[model samples]
Target: MKTQTLNVGLVGYGMAGRTFHAPLIQAAPGLELTTVVSRDAERVRADLPDVEVLSRAPALFARPDIDLVVIATPNDTHFPLAKAALGAGKHVVVDKPFSITLSEARLLKSLADEGERLLSVFHNRRWDSDFLTLEALLQAGTLGRVVALESRFDRFRPEVTDRWREHHRPGGGIWYDLGPHLLDQARALFGMPKAILLELATSREGAEVDDDFLALLEYEGLRVTLQASSLVAAPTPRFAVHGTRGSYVKYGLDPQEAWLKAGRTPAPGWGEDPLPGCLTLRDGGEPELVSREHAGLPGDYPVYYAGIAEALLHGTPPPVSVDEALEVMTLLEAGLDSYRQGRWMKLKESNGLRKRLHAH
Candidate 1:
């Protein structure tokens, strides 16, 4: 008998779905792009004419054909949607920042456990070309010991849009929006930081939310600076890592976002690095900047969905496990606390609940 394919149900048709999840879902094999729940049925149908577009999530959840549900809704609705999907015995994929708080993340984990459903998050930035290159460099130890690492995600949106992001509300700021990506990438490279120093502000006039954030992470001898701003005109170094032996500097954003926004999915040279990174070294007395092409990795966002399918079908672990997401939430809460209290927050003791999850 032929094995059954995983049927997917996407809960939103906004930028997250239109740009990231939908195209990737259709690209991956062993998965069926089944249904999408959107209020504007005409818009959703226009994009995915072949797929079934529903008006509400209940319609999608009620269908036995859907084996997995991907939640790409607002930051506030993540928990409720994930919980309801898991409760209905459907594996789920949540977008980044998982939920508004660490408690909600834990609650969803419990619900998934009780319902025996697989839960994962779409931390797709992990597969960026430059990040993959940096990961390889660090693992190879060509830089000896990494001393300081800097990662920045900046834009020149000085004027705040009418979107919910510019409004001062829960999970409506640069820290919550872009913080997860930076923090998760850091956790992937350098475990959790011992502590973090945050510099957060709202630069855009009449903006009710924070549009700028800079976090300094401290590890015994290694220090990492993560910065994101919405009002920068000049682009700074995308990535800069300094070590005892050499330094690597990469300038340019990954091409995945651009390609995805253009309705292009993962194909040959999909997430290729556009700009050649520079490698500088001081051997004897002089320093040299060596131009090198980073071997780009495929941006496999569909892998997260595929992993969820496999986990539910065979009782395996999801790609972005609940524990890993909790770690990120823990870091986020700590960063916010540090920002609010104006003092360094030790990540180790900040979220006891999250630490327990980490222990497992």
Candidate 2:
């Protein structure tokens, strides 16, 4: 069967939309960048000259040619914009932190189901070079029965800018902004944790929202730590996975976002990680560290859009499913509750709501 190209109407021209969504949508084979909703028309034209630009999201939603609506707006606007797009009979993709609240996420999912539209979140970090490498190591049993994992997304942004993410509002904090990436990756590796303990703080001098956070997710015999801070000046390992047989420690972030910001498209050797992870093993007796060059897998951000295109054009499932995102939302909320209560928040897997949602 011949596949129909999905026309994507991207809402927002900020970092997420311009740097990530636009380029990947154009790179994906079965997707077309049809329209964009941004107040800055010149900025949109500078990057995407041929793409139609609208000042308001409603204008893009009213257009009949847009088959898919990708919401890359600020954190607070995600739920409303996605709800509107789904209501307009368009498949929707909302960037991470699916919603500020779990109730909003549940409502969006219900709306998508009622409208028979595909709803997905842009959890693109699953394709990061370091993450992919870790996944391969775990699957190969290079790391046997993983017992502990540490995921960090630290930055040295000591000065708080006047951005929406820094404001004292719902979904405005380092946790909400960067937490989804770490939390989603953890949930993907290990299913929902038994409990979560979180510590949140405003470390920066002029920070209004949380600028630092540490969350511990507890499993039966495993403990996963997810952390992010804006005051870290020194280098830290992005991922540290330890198991009974071996350990994989990777230092450095994925290079795709930097490459995209520099106006470079995904090409040959695009997602190559210059700093490879070190694998230390003790399978037999003594622990020996092995250093291999370019051991990490190549990162591919375009794959998310490619899967979205395939899902909409054909009958395939979305790259990030609604239930998967819902699980992330649940964890996000649980972390916040843990922070507020100053204790561990237990997750009940056998609850009625979770059972009805069929979340794995």
Candidate 3:
């Protein structure tokens, strides 16, 4: 008998599906780009001539050959599509913020558990060069005890486009769109915060929902700030981590997203970021601080799909596990409560969503 490759059925061939999921899924060793559900069959065929393109997600879920269903649809559509896919007995991968609500994420996790199917979220930012390098530095104590960390995902899209994300829908806006990436990275580094404070703004003219946001994750003796905006024209550091011994600041975002956007496939030296972060050390008691460039680790986005394939094929762990994604979802929803109430939402042991999930 021939070796079996996991057949992936991707829903929504828009930006997430076309740029990230489809290509990364194709690059994985034990995964096959078998089918895609999209309204524009011509567009999908132009990019993937050999793959099958269907007009509806229900059709993709109903197909017997599909082993994994990757949901790259809008945030509001994620829950329904994923639920149906799982009901059809296909393993699922949801593009983040997991879903529009924490309750939905928990329900999905329960369904996956009952069905014995793999359920993962796409937190690709965890593998960015900046994030990877920072993770290494923290593990090696290069920054000593981190006191403050700031993660930003800013862009210069001043004019709001006619897109689903920019609309006034339930999951539309920069907070829901970009917040997941920053929050996931922070949670992955520092775990859940004790409390969360959020400030949202409609910075752009004629914009319906918030286009800029700032969130503060509070921990004991440490503060993690996550920000994203559509009006940031000036240059900003992708990461600025301050610790007892030193500070590591890196300007410019990772180049991996641009590489993928430019239609570059993963290969040798694909994710090696050219810009090195500057680390200022205060190891000495003297007045002067020492500063030097710190090289970043190459990003490995392909590893996500590779890990997913391993989990499905060999019973290894998925790249972005359901529990981890649920944690981010809890924060995402809590941040909204903070923004609405104009107060920090404490996340104690009694907090229903996170606490109960952790207990489980």
Candidate 1 has an lDDT of: 0.82
Give per-model TM-scores: 0.92, 0.94, 0.95
Query: If ranked by TM-score, best first, what sequence of candidates would result?
Result: 3, 2, 1
Model 2 CA deviation exceeding 4 Å by range: 1-3, 283-294, 350-360
- Regions of model 3 farther than 4 Å from truth: 1-3, 283-287, 350-360
Q: Give the winner by lDDT.
A: 3
Instruction: List model 1 lDDT by residue over 191-284, tens digit each.
Output: 7778888889989888998899999988767779999999888968889989887788888788778878877767766666668677776655
Give model 1's TM-score versus the native structure: 0.92
Error of 1 at 255 (Å): 0.3
* Model 2 residue pairs with clashes: none
Candidate lDDT values, in order: 0.82, 0.88, 0.89
TM-score of 3: 0.95
- Ranking 2 against 3 by lDDT, winner: 3
lDDT of 1 at 327: 86
